[model samples]
Target: MVSIAQGTFRTVLLTPEGRLLDCRASSVLLPSHDGMIGILRNHAPMLCELQKGIIQVKNIPDRKNAYYLIDGGFARISLNHLTILAYEVITFEGMDREQAERTAALAKESVATKGSFVSNFDEEIDPDRAAFIVKLAHLSEIGND
Candidate 1:
C-alpha cells in the first residue's frame, strides 16, 4: 500500500498580478469545482479547476492560519508542493487595521443594502460571493473591534 507521511509542504498562491503567498503549511483546503479538496504532505499529484471560495492554509511557522478568497482559476499539487493560480484573490494579509475595517464595513454594507458586492464597475456583482466576503472579513477579525 502507498504510504502518506505526516510532514509540511510548500504552498504558494499566485494571481495574474503576482505571487501572494509562499510558505510551509501542514495542510490546505482548496475549493475545487466539484467540492472542497484537502491536501497534506505526500499527496498524489494532480491538477484541478477551482471555484469561487476560500483557500485555507493551516499550521504555518511563526504565523497564524491564513485565508484567501479566490474568484476562480486552477490548482496544482505535485512533488509535495501546492500551487494555486487564481484570476483574483482577496485577503486582509497586508492591510492595516484602518483599511481592513473599511473593507469589512463596505462588504457588510454591500451585502445588507445592495444584496451584492461589486469589486469593479465593469464586473458583475455576486450576492453569494458578497456573503462569503462578509464571512471572510469576520474570520480575519476585521470588524471585531
Candidate 2:
C-alpha cells in the first residue's frame, strides 16, 4: 500500500533549490489556479498553472495525506502521465515539528506586534496547513514536544 496501481506515471515536484518529489502515485490531487484537480489513471492530457497550496497524494492505500506547500508551478498531464514541476515545494515530511511550532508561535506573536518588525511577512497563511501543524504538535507525532 505504498504506490499506485502499477502504472507508468510520474509526478515531479521541483523546488527552487532542487527537486523535492519525483515519484509515482496512485492518484494525485493538486491545487490548481482555479481550484483542486484530481488525476487518476488515463486522465486527459493537459497543462495548467498552479497556485500556492497543498498537493495531496494517495500513494499508499488507506494512508494519510501527503502534504506539500507549493509556491507556484505548472502541471502537465499527458496520456496518463502527470508531472508537477514547481518553483518551490515544501514537504511536510521534511518539516521540523519543533521548528513549525516555533514559527507558528512567532507568526501569532508577530500578528499582534506593530512596527517595522513585521515589514515582510506572508499576508495570508493557509489555515489547513496551520491546523495540521498544530494537530501534529498536539499529537506529538513528528517528534514534537
Candidate 3:
C-alpha cells in the first residue's frame, strides 16, 4: 500500500481520570462504535463514539506503537489534531504482557465454567459479556496487531 504518508499531527488522549498521552503521530487507529477507524494528517473533521477495543497510535518518532484499551469514549479528528475523551483508559505502557495474558486466560476459563454465571438483584454477569471482556483484554495485551 502506497500512502502519500505525508505530515504529522498531535493526538491527545484523555480519560475522566486524566490525560493519558499527547504526542505527535503520523496516524491513529481508533476503536469506534462501528469498528476500527484510521485517521491521518489532513483528514476530514469527524466525530465517533467508541466502544470496547484498543486504540493504536502509529508512526511515533523514536518509539513503537502505543496502545490503549478504552471502555467507551468519543473521538474527534479535525485539522490534523485528534482528541480522545474516554470514560476509562487502560494503557499498555510498562504493563506486564505475560501477566495480562494469563489473567485474560483465567477470565475466559471462568466464563466457560459450566453454571458459573452469576447474577445479583442489582447487576447480572452473563457468560457472553464475560467472554467479550476477556477477548478485549487478550487483544489489548497482544498489542502487536
Candidate 4:
C-alpha cells in the first residue's frame, strides 16, 4: 500500500539543450504518443513515447506549479522518479512578466494570423503549436498579466 508520505515524486524534464526542471511534484500529466497519462508517486516503472503537448507538474513544494510545451520525445518512470526527455521544451518558469506576455501575444497572433511565428529561440511555431502554447500559457497563468 502507498503511504501518505509517498504522495510526491521527483520529476525531471530535459531537452537536448539541457535540464529544465528538477523538482518534487504531487502529480504529473504527460502526453503519451497514444494519449494522456497521469502519474503519481509509486507508479509502476515504464517507458513511453511522448507527443507534442503540455506537461503539467502540480503541487510543487515552495514553487509555483509548472507547465511545459514539449515536442515529441520519451518519458521514463521508475523508483519514484519521472524523467522526460524531449527534443524541445518551452515554459515560462524563468521568464519575467514582460517576456511571458510577449510570448503569449506572439502565440495568439500566430494562431489568429494562421501563419508560422518564430520564437525567441528561433524555432518556428505553426498555428497548431502556437495554439497549444497559448493554452499552456493560460494554464500556467504566466501570461495572464
Best-matching candidate per TM-score: 4
Q: State each model's CA lDDT, in order.
A: 0.84, 0.62, 0.72, 0.90
Runs of candidate 3 with Cα error greater than 4 angstroms are 1-5, 107-145
Model 3, range 48-81, lDDT digits (tens) per residue?
9998777888899887778776778899988888
Q: What's each prediction's TM-score?
A: 0.87, 0.63, 0.70, 0.92
Better of 1 and 3 by lDDT: 1
Q: In the order shown, what is each candidate's alpha-carbon RMSD?
A: 3.1, 6.0, 5.1, 1.9
Residue 91 of model 2, lDDT score: 52
Candidate 4 wrong stretches, greater than 4 Å: 1-6
Please give, for residues 57-98, the per-residue lDDT of candidate 2 as tens digits: 666344454667677789999866677888645454655656
TM-score of 2: 0.63
Give the Å error, residue 71, model 3.
Answer: 1.4
Report the C-alpha displacement of residue 83, candidate 3, in angstroms. Answer: 0.5
> On residues 19-54, what C-alpha lDDT tens digit does candidate 4 reach at each position?
999999999999999999999888999999999999
Locate the minimum summed-lDDT window of 10 residues in model 2. 114-123
Order of candidates by TM-score, top first?
4, 1, 3, 2
* Higher-TM-score candidate of 3 and 4: 4
